[model samples]
Structures are given as structure tokens and as C-alpha cells.
Target: AGEAIITPADKKHPPTIPVTGAAVTIGVELGCAATPQSLQINGNLSNAVEGSVTPSIQGTGTVSGNGSGGSTGGQGGGSGSLSITPGLSATAADTVTTGGSLTGDIGPGTTRDFPIATKPLSGRDGYVVARETRVSVDGCLGGAQIRSYATAVISTPLGENSITTYGRTLFIDRDHPGAPPKLKPAK
Candidate 1:
């Protein structure tokens, strides 16, 4: 929500406030359990101003499924966790956290939903806005060769429409049982 007020209630002339378009930043990180249990990471965005920004995910490891985004009003806070349905024989340990709702369907080597806002932000000047992206090991299971990570895109019609980021890498060796799974950040 955005509200405006006269700064200096008693002042004769109110100074003109400088409004800057919001700047969007995307970040990716890996989250791992103690053992070779699961792989996960956090994806976050910092908006320099106030507005509605759409976030989407695309990856090689996961197949794209159909899903709708959440409601479109007010400010959505915090990065929530999403459990992806496994497409392969592997157990369901994979998950992804995108500030926006998951769009694509959930399955091994398949990324989640893509959110496109019908309404653009008002392009008002405000405080710094923070959003999160989380990627878990559950997404890297199943299939002949599991894709390690996915690519993230944050877009806003206000200024820069699209900014791209990537996920970390997971090393899974079926032959070497003793060699536990390893998680590495995107290079």
C-alpha cells in the first residue's frame, strides 16, 4: 500500500519530492541438508521503489507444468516454500521458493509456475521492497540426467522489464553410493 502526506504540516510550500523508478535485483543461493538428503537454495529480490513485479522460473531439470498465480493486490511479504511433486521414482524432497506463486506444474526436472501480472505497478516512489526465492533438492531428482538448477527471471514494466539469474549445481552420482550429493553455487 502507498500513501502520501504533506511533509511539514505547517510549511507554506511543500518541497517537490524526487521519485525514482524501482530497480529490481535477483539473487540465487543453495540450501543443503546435513547429509545428501536434499538440495535447496534461496532466491530473493530487492525493489528500490514501490510497484508490482512479476517473477518467473525456467530450468532444464524440470518439466513445465500448468498452474495459476496468486491474487493480485496489496503487498506480498516473505518467501514461502513450495514442494514439487516428483516425476521419477525418487522421494519428494525437492522444493522451490519464489516470491510469487508457482506457475508451471511440479515434477522432477520441471520448474514451477510463471507469474505475469495483468496490472503494472503505479510506479510510485517508496521504500525498499524485499522478496525471496528458495530452491530445494526436491527439484533435482528423477529422470536420466537430473538438471541441477533453474534460471530465474524478474520483470517489471516500470523500468527494466527483465532481469535474469540462475540456480546452484548439484552433483549426484548413482554409482558412487559413498559419494554423497554435493551442492555448488552457480558460477
Candidate 2:
């Protein structure tokens, strides 16, 4: 992990800030089904700012949660998008017997918007994946649910100038690829 010396939006009175909000993910249940189902969602959110790093780092972040059309089964399918206001919060949630559930948050951090590092801040793209299962009363229904978020930032080392930059997230997956997980750990 790399340490990010965040330049405050205000240059006159700079404050100590770090690059937070790496991403948060939660596994969801897709419910039980007579047949297995595969789904995928894709989206991109980006924002760039240009200003002095004195009183405040001048810039705004604009992200649109518009995912690619989702796949559907013979019975049903799903689709959605998010238009978030700058410095505002947005949320959505729901539940069904067959499809699992998901609750997620994608926006700027409490202290600041994701640092728009001038260069690829080690694009290590650090991320965390979580999984969970919730069974129905009959024990024959319920599926694993998962939700993940990734965050990154970059900037010049202290005693230097800054530049303009931006970033976004890419959600991807292979439907039923059929690649089994390795049972044994690498020696």
C-alpha cells in the first residue's frame, strides 16, 4: 500500500488528509431457483479538477452508475442506473424470494472526493471481495450475494507541484466460465 499525501482543496490553510474509501463490498443472495442464472453489470464514473492546492483543492467528481444491460432468464431480468449529485449521497435497496439482495454506497469520502492522483497511483487497484448466504425457511432456496467497491488516488510528493487527473471503476465478470478454484494453496 502506498501513502497518499492529499493536498487539501484549500491552499491558504492546508489540512492533513489521506486517500480513503478504497471500496466496500457485501455478498448478496440471489434466492433459490429451479435453474442457475448468470448476471453482469458494468459502469464507469469519472471526475477531474483543476485548481491551486492552497485553501482547497479545486475540482469536482462526476460518476454515473449506468451499468450495461443485464442478462435475463426465461422469466425475468433487471436493469438500473445512478445519477449522483456532487457532494450528495444516493442509495437503493430491495428484496425478492428468488433473486438475492444488495445494499451498496458509491460516492466521495466523508472528508474528500477520491484523490485525483496526477498519475496512476500504483494502479495496484487494491480491492476486497466478500460472500454471504441466506437460506429460506425451506432450506431449498437462497443464493450467494456479493457487492464490491474499488477506490484509488495519486499525487506529487511533498515539496512539489500538482497536476490534473481523473479515474473510474470497471465491473466485470465471466458468466459460468466453469473454471474451478484451486483446492491447494501455492507452495
Candidate 3:
């Protein structure tokens, strides 16, 4: 991550205040020791930000979900685009169920969008976007990591601006001692 300042090259530069802008660049490398054939990702959306995870598989696989669509509320609204890939299968739904296994098929090399918004009924503290996602990639021997991008818009009296952030999450099967107890341990 890094940042730089840009100064105007106009005559007013003598007394001009340099505008300072920041840029953040993030990168990650996930090492999977074994070959994976299938992949699954259970995701969540919270408080004014939207994101998605894409799993690329070399062979056939199934994904379960409510499909894709858009919704609007008194506060805000969001929409999703459909995946257009040959041999791809999917289910359609107006609302995406939380904490449930999604049922659908995302074509290889394509991605899906999961829109998120803070519920209107949320009380003060606004909303803490804390949720656990379980990811399963068949044939993975070591571990798996997923990365995605999230963006939010900040509105103020001055103006409104959008900012983007990178997110990374790791997946460990219950077979490993580090896995949460709720997850079924390997037999």
C-alpha cells in the first residue's frame, strides 16, 4: 500500500495547498498443496457494502443459491447481474437467504455479485459486519484462501465519495484441530 500527493501546476501554485490523495494496493498469494475439483463459498453482506467470491474449477461443480436480482428500500437499494456462461445453471430469487448453503451453478471463469446493505431496523452502533463464512473446495490437501473487493460510499455535507477495500479470508476444514468445533470434524 502507498500514497502520493498531487500539486496543481498553475500560476496559483505560489500559495496553493497541495491536495493529498491516498491509494492503497493489496495483493495476496494462496497456496493449495493438492488439486481441487469442486469449490463452495458461503458469503455475507453487511452495512452499505457489497462483494462476491469467484471459485474457478477445472471440472463440473454445483453451487446453491437464490440466483440473482435487485431490491430497493426506503434507505437504499442494489442489484446483481446474471452469469452468462455456456452450460451454467442457476436459481432465481428476490432475496438472498443468510447463513444457508446456496444452490446453483456458476460457469467456470465467470463470477457472481452479492449485494449488501445495512438493515433499516439496525440500532445505534449502526451495524457490525461480523459473520463467518465456510468455504469447501473438494480435493484440497492443505488450506484455501479467498480474496474479494468491497466498496462503500461516504456522504457528508461537503460531498459524497466512494472508497474500495480488499478483503481476504482463509478456509480450514474441520479435519484440522484449528477448525471451529461447530464444524464437523473429520472422521
Q: Write the per-residue lDDT of candidate 1 for residues 137-163, one digit (tens) a residue.
A: 443433222222222222334433333
Clashes of each: 20, 21, 7
> Which numbered prediction scores highest in lDDT against the true structure?
3
Q: Which candidate should be chosen as best, given TM-score against the real structure?
A: 3
lDDT of each: 0.35, 0.33, 0.40
Which stretches of model 1 miss by more than 4 angstroms? Answer: 1-19, 27-108, 113-135, 139-159, 173-187
Cα deviation at 7, candidate 1, in Å, is 30
- Per-model TM against the reference: 0.20, 0.16, 0.23
Better of 2 and 3 by lDDT: 3
Name every residue pair that clashes in candidate 3.
63-103, 63-104, 64-102, 64-103, 64-104, 65-102, 65-103
Answer with 1 or 3, whichever has the higher lDDT: 3
Q: Candidate 2 lDDT, tens digit per residue, 23-51?
A: 22222222222222333455544444334
Candidate 2 has its poorest 10 consecutive residues by lDDT at 108-117
Off by over 4 Å in 2: 1-5, 16-141, 151-187
Preferred candidate (TM-score higher): 1 or 2 = 1
